[model samples]
Target: MSEMQSTRRGRPGYDQQGILAVAVAAFNEHGYDATSIGMLAERLGLSKSAIYHHFGSKDQILDLALDAALSGLEAVVDDPLPASAVEASAVARLEHVLRGAVHVLIAQLPAVTLLLRVRGNTEVERRALTRRRAFDRRITALVSEAQAEGALRADMDASVVARLTFGMINSIVEWYRPGGREGADRLADDVVAIALDGLRRR
Candidate 1:
């Protein structure tokens, strides 16, 4: 439906959020092109029309799911660091952003997994890909600034560091399990420690 399912319908049924969660999982597992409305409907136990009523198409669902992933990371980038961190050096700021990225990835693993799988076969995917590159550039700028300030090793290319840093963080999607014993904060801290230890100027 164009609106949420009525409260009278009971909580077992899927609403837009519930459906989108399933859609993200489906897309992540099968790839966006490999999935279909029929499969989503079957999984939700709702007809395709019900899904279409809530969303224009599978593309729309993907767009929203990817938004969920992007919003968290964007928040970390756009928001100022905590009071103590406000005057932190360039490398510290870079480390803060990078650590926050790991937290974002862990918090939104499923949506991010879907985002990382996008191949630009459709307009939605292309837009997502563009936004991703823009985010990468922002981080790369931070890397370059740290290098210029003599905070990071100048020998390595900033762009290479950006790619390798993200490559390692994003790789968590392949194996990191949510609600695990190690917890989000520890994982993010460990990632920051490992990534920055090698990057900091000796």
Candidate 2:
């Protein structure tokens, strides 16, 4: 079967955002293997060919959807640290970046969740994993700085700390809702506080 025929949809037309919204929802609900282009087209009232026009194949669609989520994360990581060394300590800079990351994770939870779930079964997923590792490395560097500056506890390995930190941050995707008792800002504060100060109250 042709790529479109196998996927059961045409290139995506209409608003790219709208199409991505529908496609991501479909992928989330049905999973990558189960979702068909026909179903997506039916949902959007378009032909399978329409989606194919927008995306070359199912994998292409998945890559674009995943990118949409990771792009938000990339934005957070790309933010510049304070220009003056005295302006903020390493820990403060780390907190700022973490807070920005929380916004990205919460705002783009669906896409990010999908992005995190990739199993490396395809080339797209493998590429996603590489990018995810790079992001983690940058965070590790910040953690190392925090340790050197005495802002963060130095007992633990920076790589280990970075892994745990991101592990906690990424977990937000699993449980976060758009509106709840705590919003993104509040959640970010709570996360940073919990990280900086242990759960035990003095």
Candidate 1 local lDDT, 1-202, one digit each (tens): 4344545445447777889988988888888888999999998889999889779988899999999998888887786788988877789889889889988998899998988888888899899999899999999999999999998999998999999999999999998987677787898887887887854666
Report residue 88 deviation for candidate 1 (angstroms).
2.7
Per residue, candidate 2 scores C-alpha lDDT tens digits across 1-202 of 4322324333334555567778888888888889899999999888888777777887888898888877888877777675765467778878888899899888888898888788898999999988888888888998999999888889999999988877898899878878878899999998898888878989
Give, for candidate 2, the lowest lDDT window spanning 10 residues: 3-12
Candidate that would win on TM-score: 1
Record all residue pairs in model 1 with backbone atoms less than 3 Å apart, i.e. clashing. none
Query: How far in Å is the alpha carbon of 165 misplaced in model 1?
Result: 0.7
- lDDT values, one for every candidate: 0.86, 0.82
What 10-residue stretch in candidate 1 is worst by lDDT?
2-11
Residue 177 error for model 2, in Å?
Answer: 1.6
Q: Judging by lDDT against the true structure, name the best candidate.
A: 1
- Cα deviation at 5, candidate 2, in Å, is 26
Off by over 4 Å in 1: 1-12, 199-202
* Candidate 1, RMSD to the unseen true structure: 3.7
